[model samples]
Target: MKMSKVFRLLFIGMVALSVLLAGCSKSNQATSGDKKPNELVVGQDANPTTMDPHDTQDTLAYGIQKTMYEGLLGFDKDMQVIPVLAEAMPELAKDAKSLTFKLKKGIKFQDGTDFNADAVKANIDRLKDPANKLKRASLYAAIDHVEIVDPYTVKIVLNKPFAPIVQAFAHPAGLMISPKAIKEYGKDLNRHPVGTGPFQFVEWKDGQYVVVKKFDGYWDKANAAKVEKITFKPVPETASRIAMLKTGEAQFIYPLPPEQTESVKGDSNVVVDKAQSTIIRYVVFNVNQKPFDDKRVRQALNYAVDKDALNKVVYRGFASAPESAIAPKVWGFQKQQMYAYDVEKAKKLLAEAGLPNGFEITLWTPNDTIRAKIAEFVQQQWQIIGVKATIQQMEFVTLTNQLSLKPEESKLQAAVSGWSPSTGEADWGIRPLLSKNMFPTAGFNSGFYVNDQLDKYVVTGLESGDEKERLNAYAEAQKVIVEDAPWVFLTVPDNLVGKRKNLSGVYVLPDATQDVVHAEFK
Candidate 1:
């Protein structure tokens, strides 16, 4: 009540103190400092089928191995094709059918093996070996062989002038490993991996984890991984993985549960790193099957499911709604094409396909949580259209092997399968997945949807190096898949990555390759 100047100043000071206390209570920074982890650990969904880079198609293998190896060509941060191991990008012969690579001198493999033309030849020979059973055999099937021009240079002879040559070498499937290391370790490379990579294998506990230490001899060792050691422990269960992160038992994680992504949105210790990915989830329908053979049936399936509903109720809005078979992040997406959800339209289509009420279909899905959830959500949506889908769950390995069978032998009707990009290769979305030429064997085209136009465009896309021509060809290919509806394009993804604050350079590719070098735990 006393209006003295000193009292007024005291009252103002008291008000300031109150505000400061309230601010301190809410301030995250006041409690503690954010400390970076000392090592970078990763969680992989699966183990590598082969440690030999040339003989494996498993993406997890590539992700872990890339930190330890280099390709003749590489994609920069901008996805521009450039030289990595080579002195410069390979020059195509006048005919453009032959690729000549000039190697960098004084380069050494992790095993201290000489890196030369002979080393390149040995690696090429191993990739060509049929006994290896590599998943990417088709990518190299056309290669005539490697010809060493000299110790520092070599030439690759293709049967024809195959374009996308720069793209081919940059794919994780195409990275080079030391020939000496392969000969010494053979397939036991997992336990004793030797590469030009920045890290060296320390131990691997199958289904548990893998550990690696920094290889000080790496070409970019000074700027390479900062961690002294890394451990990759597996907690396959979604809840368990998240629980590990909460307890600080795990420093990094992947594919954070759809519902749990929000938990790390702005935390001081943890972070959610989101990026566009080449992964697309969809329900793959076998075109060779009876009901699916009818385009109307495929359209019905696409129309019945509300992708918005799936993203909301199932994915909790953590995923984006897919519009086309090719992801929007990938070049050549056909924007005008998408199968809109129309319950009545789906019903009419089903009726047109001679099923007025509904049809029974078997839906196969992996035992994993996300995939199972997607299948269940799709199953619910199908019920609205009178289509009853019975869920059959199996492990990924068994499920994938089972899916790759003759339609007659498949014993299941429609199944949920996802497509992923290969260094942003449109062929990853087209040929090997939809062409009759790749039916049930070469790749995911287990559905055997043979559109002559898709096949021609796929070939054309793969045959041309011109960006305009290739993109135009892929655009046409996307149109074919959308119109054909061989599969219900569900959602393209933003990769869900949760990491400790200290890890830098955690390179996650638009494709599936994950790199740790250039990453340091500060």
Candidate 2:
């Protein structure tokens, strides 16, 4: 899974070239009085691992996939859920098992195909397809059947009254696809996508760039992206991303670190915005390991690490100390009143576990400044407890692979990772990472830290859309995770974006949306 630096560098260079093309494009003919281009050019670090919306599990993938696909529901300016493809929120039947959705008419796929109830069926059936190979298949497994009541109406019958179904539609796995496109292209439809969205797929040069063009036939063209062509360039380094932003080589950076926030504060031409991000960073314990297998050892690790110090040194005060896996921005988040940085307590717990002298363990992270610095801080903290720590770094996807190994097949002892909340809820952040049933038998829950009590609360939170009930369930789950300490809860990131003076609409919501979607020059 590793590649030579030469190829990686070349790939980066090509991405730089793509950015230059987007910055210099004359196609679609959008220009200002100063003759600036109308096309919105964006930059990222790498190509999305998978373009198939349902197969991806990262913010980058969700951000890109959202551009070309519309879900049954979508988040608005305030991140409030509203109907898009759906004319109205589904109405629950008296039986409570059947949900009926009224579809919006006059919507057409990018390929001039009509969109109706049949299209909805096609979209849902694909993700529900047993052979689809989509990672999110489990989300829809309980769906009994979908009946098309009319051209503009569809009814979904579930095995149970799943109230969170509306929010689930906002997930990438629930993005609506063109039935004709899928039927014609089969599995390759991900590469060659067709949807009823603001943008249409144009070209994707592997590991370099992904380009999309505006669709003239979009239903709501008024708020349709102001720009013409949108090109996303993969630029991995923060300094490089910030440097290029200053040069006007790139208009918007996905995330300019907190370290650079103050640097850009004085620059009138550049603006920096910060808000609590739904993404939470943390270090996970491999429960299969003997020391970590003991709840006392896990809790001790939590007490040993200084999250505040780690936040200051690594995140430059751009993060909030997370008491649990879910961020403070989420509704009904139980604030862990205080994080215990008790060296004596940690030592005592280790002694109780028959390891007074401490033990050696591997702490793994992806190769990045924030990750590496955080690992160094944890390494120092572990040292105080008389434990020798070995720090290792790998690619983000590689780390995902190691932690995703099956129970008996896992090689990782512990790793640093976190979730980017795609659905803007704790249900997404906690369930998929900790719940045994959410991930495949050999997938992300490779830590195999099963707690039926925790699973019950997470499921309860997800099954009911009733705000009070869901929030209470989430609060209970957070308390359990804090006491259990399967992972060292770190901090909630502040979404930081640096944009040139000319760029407009550079916004960040604490959810899955991560792209510079509507960026434009004044």
Candidate 3:
């Protein structure tokens, strides 16, 4: 053969190999597609601190744990309390001190133990037990005793009329765990959570991922898990989380930062879901600390920071400044006159509090992108008033633990934080944050604020079953708390979730937790 003919033959052979490889690639693609999983992967802001339903105060943890646990009560999309394990709403006595619930029958825990009146009693007993020292124990303090009327019937006797009891029961703190698991694991139950939710705990790889699988014996088949498995992966970086969603690495990601919403919306493969949130973002002060101990200084900080600017810059106007101690979406929210933005007025208040020169303070925030931005904005705003704010960012878990320290031991001066009244009620909005008894060791009142009048009003709100009376009481409490300025009230942000367009049935609730019970891949 001539040299030209040999060159032509070599070219033909190369082209043939390319065609063969292309066909093999197509075959591999089809084979991989056929084995695609019916699983949901969620990218969240942070790792859950615990799996124990009764022990955690961490919002992220509770949200994930919700998939594996359920309470006798559950909340609808509107945050209204509804019966879940219970057959119907409880029957209240004339005095409102006693209530009875009829449990649903044929429900079994993930551990195969029966879910009955006995399970309810076991949970209540654990929460009320002084030795257990659960983080949410104070929420159930009004419960005097639990009486089993039958296998499926139970009566709760409260020491007094606790108006928010039913609503509180709808909270994750009320989520029931297997009594058998509770007894076996005891202190270590955080590692081995077992419940009767639509999903059962598969495993938790700390700082990595947590997984749950469909519970085959899940009682409510109509609302059963639509996916074989759900994996919660903590991707604290905002950009990384969005990239995961866009690339199909995750089915859902929350909360989609407000600034990034428009960008994510433009992606055809992703959908943004918004829910009006009960989350109240604020900068809480440590009243036990020097300058902050002065209400005028606290008020000055609130006056100094322009809430409208903060919302515009940090939340891109997707958030609104809180008009009450609680978000307006929560039940019994009463609007109040909040501190107006005035740098001069802020300086005046500081001078009146004997700090005319302005003092130096530390503001701690979680190492979150948004929160760090909040701290930075607050720092710049306070600078105009001669206030030198040194911003410190730490891991969320560390920041939370630092704040939980007893007032005398805690070194927290000011911290940027947020709370969602996950219970969707006024008492939860006020009691855990402002009531005197809630200080440090007892509840989330890390500020160590004390006001006898405010305390009385919260108690009144909690003890009264009358709607009018409770409303009036909460109104008064909000007035006192707003005036005292324990916190530089920030914004009530909308819960933003980014999901794959093909996904449905999962959403971020008004309380800002993910409800994944019905999540499915289309």
Candidate 4:
């Protein structure tokens, strides 16, 4: 009996040992598999002031929002409008007063709410609400009301015939937020974003980084999020960003300084992408203030600056001199050389403007390396015409706030800035910058420059149904704006981008934002 008991105990011990070894083997295999690819890290030069789509006016902020929120429509690589949440391109009524959109079926928001026509209506109502005070309200000023035809169909009625309404829907102004999330978060929705995009907002570490993760339940699984995670690190210093890219810490960086392009290209593990951009850098004269109020003074400044030399020196030959406010790729862009580098003509114009001895002025510029260089170059050139130019640099947000203020309150004489129309339309590019109705804190016309003739042409371009008429109207408006010289047209910069060699599916849109939804590590 004692021998039988001992044998049974031995058998039990062996079985237990076998089970322990099997469990260890399985755990080892799982651990090896869990070592997946690292997340993609993108380095940006600026941090977004807010994440709310309706409140943000900065491009970087919009780029971050694009990862989490999607509009009814979106722009393709060629800048053409394409349907996103919508089933197809919206059908316009014969009278051109309404647009009907068929929403994609079976889509659900990240917050588990059903996405329907009512959600679209709710988004529009929130944006159009005066109590919300959205900066993008002006973009949807033409919307009379939204009608839900069914669970998956909606119609947007316009107060009048507006040409840019369709294009506006593709912009950040048309980004659809989850109504359920909005109701829950309310004023805090900027930080708590919920949408039906391929990625979901994970967390935002203030002044450090904003992180996002792939949404497994994304409707479009074919082009679903490839990367497991993405972290947008705010590295304002160009050198730091370059260092991060080289050390394999960051996979992408924007606005790569022209000087560093060659070095980045020399690296075997990195690549550079250069695309023609719609960004126009210019100096906005405070027409509400002295000397600048005179067209002759503005024209003289435009003539005095050697744009070609500025492009070569500041942009390192990576920029093209703009003929007008609109870029060359934009329709209705004039090929005419509106202003040539003529010191003598500039001097003559200054004398004609009754400032023969030249007047002292302060030129404000954002605290950006490129803009600062441009400002310094302009200051030197203006000195040749006896203009005592003082350069003052401030943060971009602060400068924009000062520019938005009334001339008496802001004391802004002139500021160096740039504008990129995200809509990819000439009407959008010209209207907000030159229209009188857009002045005094209405959609980026901070210079407060007003021209009745230009405004009329812009309005006609926005209201006309015929393409040729709209083209002619915009062309004429450009000519008038060049003559008025509200801004000294400088150069259209090339979007210089840097990325790791292993990073694929990254593209710079015409509007100069990175499309990283399909980005992956090879």
- lDDT computed for candidate 4: 0.85
* Whole-model lDDT values for every prediction: 0.75, 0.76, 0.88, 0.85
The weakest ten consecutive residues by lDDT in model 1 span 28-37
| Tens-digit lDDT track of model 1 for 335-386 | 6458788999999998888999897888998776778888999999899888
Model 3 residue 516 distance off true place after TM-score fit, in angstroms: 0.9
Please provide, for model 4 over 1-522, each residue's C-alpha lDDT reduced to its tens digit, 9 standing for 90 to 100: 356888999999999999999999777643431233558889887666677887766777777888888899999888899999999999999999999999999888998899999999999999888788777787888999999999999999999999889999999768889999889999999899998889999999876999999988899888899888999987767778888887777888887878788889998878999989988999998898889889999999999999999999988899998878789887667665489999999999999999998999999997767788889999999899999889999867677678766545768788898888889888878877777777645567888888889888888888999989998998888888888899988889999998887788887787777788788877
Record all residue pairs in model 1 with backbone atoms less than 3 Å apart, i.e. clashing: 68-197, 358-386
Q: Which lDDT value does model 4 have at 270?
A: 80
Q: Give the Å shift of residue 296 in candidate 2.
A: 1.7
Pairing residues by index, what is the TM-score of model 3?
0.94
Candidate with maximal lDDT: 3
lDDT of 1 at 374: 89
**How accurate locally is residue 19 in candidate 1, as Cα lDDT from 0 to 100?**
97
Winner by lDDT between candidate 4 and candidate 3: 3
Best by TM-score: 3
Which regions of candidate 2 fall more than 4 Å away from where they truly are?
A: 1-35, 441-443, 463-467
Model 3: residues with Cα > 4 Å off, grouped in runs: 1-36
lDDT of 2 at 100: 90
What order do you get sorting by TM-score, best first?
3, 4, 2, 1
How far in Å is the alpha carbon of 135 misplaced in model 4?
1.5
